[model samples]
Target: MNNEEAARARVVSTADRLFYAQGVQAVGMDAVRSASGVSLKRIYALYPSKDDLVLAVLRHRTEQWNTGLAKAVAAAGTPRDKMLAVFDFLAEWFREDDFRGCAFINFFGELGGGNSKVAAAVREQKTSFQRHVAGLVRDAGGPGHLAPQLALLAEGAQTTAAITRDPGTAAQARAAAETLIRCAFE
Candidate 1:
């Protein structure tokens, strides 16, 4: 990559790690500069402002996170397996050393009310995820409406796992999904 591209990548990566580890409000641009080792001039030239940086970081994370989920779902053997794979994805994410729950959820909690752009981004991510689950449900011969319920289970599992520091919540969510699937389609 060119110098500018490389610098921008480093800044975004560093910002993502710092913001996720510490809340967006808690981590300042200076901290990002120090952590990223990118000069302050380059940071501002690239991001312009902390809000801009935060938005960029959120967008970057949204893509990476969703891409990972899509891969996990695609790898499953069947539609039902695909549906359950959502929880499997969550369990793996929760087990990550730096996992801080869903980045969209955490971002919303931090700045959604105050920032319309951030709120919209978070909403888009959630809507997209729900639709993904709904598609899997449809493929599995289940009612599409059950997608929201399944999404809720996955969200709850993530939140619970985050708060309780328990990756096993994914299993609980998978069990719940199994029950829901059985009752809905079987």
Candidate 2:
């Protein structure tokens, strides 16, 4: 990578870990500079401001999160299995040593009330997720309309797992989704 590109990537990567681990509001630019080993002058030149850096991090995370989910779902054998694979993805994610739940959810909780840009990014991530779930439901012979309910269960699983630090919540959510999908077809 070019020098500027390398610096920007370092800043964003460092910020992603710090912001997700602590919180966006809790992490500061100096901390990002220190953690990334990027000079403060370059950090500012790349991101322009903390908000800019935050927006970049959120956007980067959204892409990565969506890609991971899609890959997991695709690896399943059947439509129904694909639908259930979302919880499998969650299970693995929650088991990660540094699992911090949904970054968008955390970011929204931290700054959604005051920051329009952050709020927008959060909403976009959620909307995209729900849309993906809805498509999976439709493909799996469940009503697409039931996507919201399924999304609720998936999100609940993530929240509960994050709070309780228990990966088992994913199984519970998957079981609940199975019931919801079965009932939707009946």
Candidate 3:
């Protein structure tokens, strides 16, 4: 990557970890600067304001998650397997030592329905993720309308696992999804 791109990436990567682990409101500019090893001036140059940086971090995370999910689905051999892969992916993610709640959801929780641009970006990112998952469900030959419900179940499961520290929630979600898919196809 070019120098500028590399610097911006450093900022985003650091900010992503901080923002995800701590609420957006809790993390400060100085923390980002220190974590990234970049000057405050450089951070400001890249992102004029904390809100801008927050939005950038959110976008970066959204891209990373979408790419990961897409790869997971693609690697699965069958449509049902692809659908099950979503839950498997979440189960694995929750097992990570640094795993926090969903970034978008966390951001939304932090903002608490503010009228900020970052809030809008978080909402958009969530909608986009749901749509992406929905598309995968459609490709798996499930009814077109089943995508939203499946997405909800998957997201609900993620939240439950994160909150309850129960990985079994993911397994149960996968089994339930398989049953739904079978019913839809039959």
Candidate 4:
């Protein structure tokens, strides 16, 4: 890549790690500059403002997550397996020592509304995910409501596992999801 692209990437990467670890509000421009080894002028030039930078980071992370989830689902053999893959994915993620929580959820928590662009982007990403899973359920001939139910369970599992640091909660959540899927199919 060119120097400009590389420099911008460094800034985003640094911001991504810091924002994920400390939070968006807690991490300032100077911290990002120091961590990225990029000048404040360059950072501002690339992003225009901190809010813009935060939105970029959120969009990048959201795309990364959706790509990972799509891969996990595609790798599974059956529709049921694909559906269950969400839990498996979360379970493995939660096992990581640095896994704080879902970045989008955490971003919203930190910002607490007011940024219309970020809020809209987050809502669009979430709705896309829900529709993706819902499409899978529809294809599997499960009940119409099955997708949202499983999505709620999956979301709850992520929150609970993050909060409690209990892997068992994920397993229980997976089991609950399985039961729901089976019931829907029956």
Instruction: Give TM-scores for every candidate, taking all chains together and pairing residue i with residue i.
Output: 0.97, 0.97, 0.93, 0.95
Check candidate 4 and list the clashing pairs.
none
Candidate number with the higher TM-score (1 or 4): 1
What residue runs in model 3 are displaced by over 4 Å at the alpha carbon?
none
Better of 2 and 4 by TM-score: 2
lDDT of 3 by residue, 1-186 (tens): 899999999999999988887778889999999999999999999999988888898889888888888888888998878888888888788788877668777787777488477678877887887787777777787888778777888889878877988778878888888888888889
Which parts of model 1 are misplaced by more than 4 Å? none
Q: Where does the lowest 10-residue lDDT sum fall in candidate 4?
A: 109-118
On residues 1-186, what C-alpha lDDT tens digit does candidate 1 reach at each position?
999989988999999999899999999899999999999998999989888998899889988978999899989999899999998999888898877788788989999999999999899888988889999999998987689999999999988988998888898999999999889986
Q: Indicate the worst ten consecutive residues by lDDT in candidate 1.
A: 96-105
Q: RMSD of candidate 2 to the true fold?
A: 1.0
Q: Per-residue lDDT for 10-67 in model 2, tens only?
A: 8999999999999988898999989999999989989898999999999889989999
RMSD of 1: 1.0
TM-score computed on alpha carbons, candidate 2? 0.97
**CA lDDT for candidate 2:** 0.92
By lDDT, the best candidate is 2
Candidate 4 structure, TM-score to reference: 0.95
How much is 175 displaced in model 3, in angstroms?
1.2
Clashes of each: 0, 0, 0, 0
Candidate 4, 86-185: lDDT as tens digits: 8887787888898887787888777848787778777877888899889888877788799999888988887787788887777898899999998887
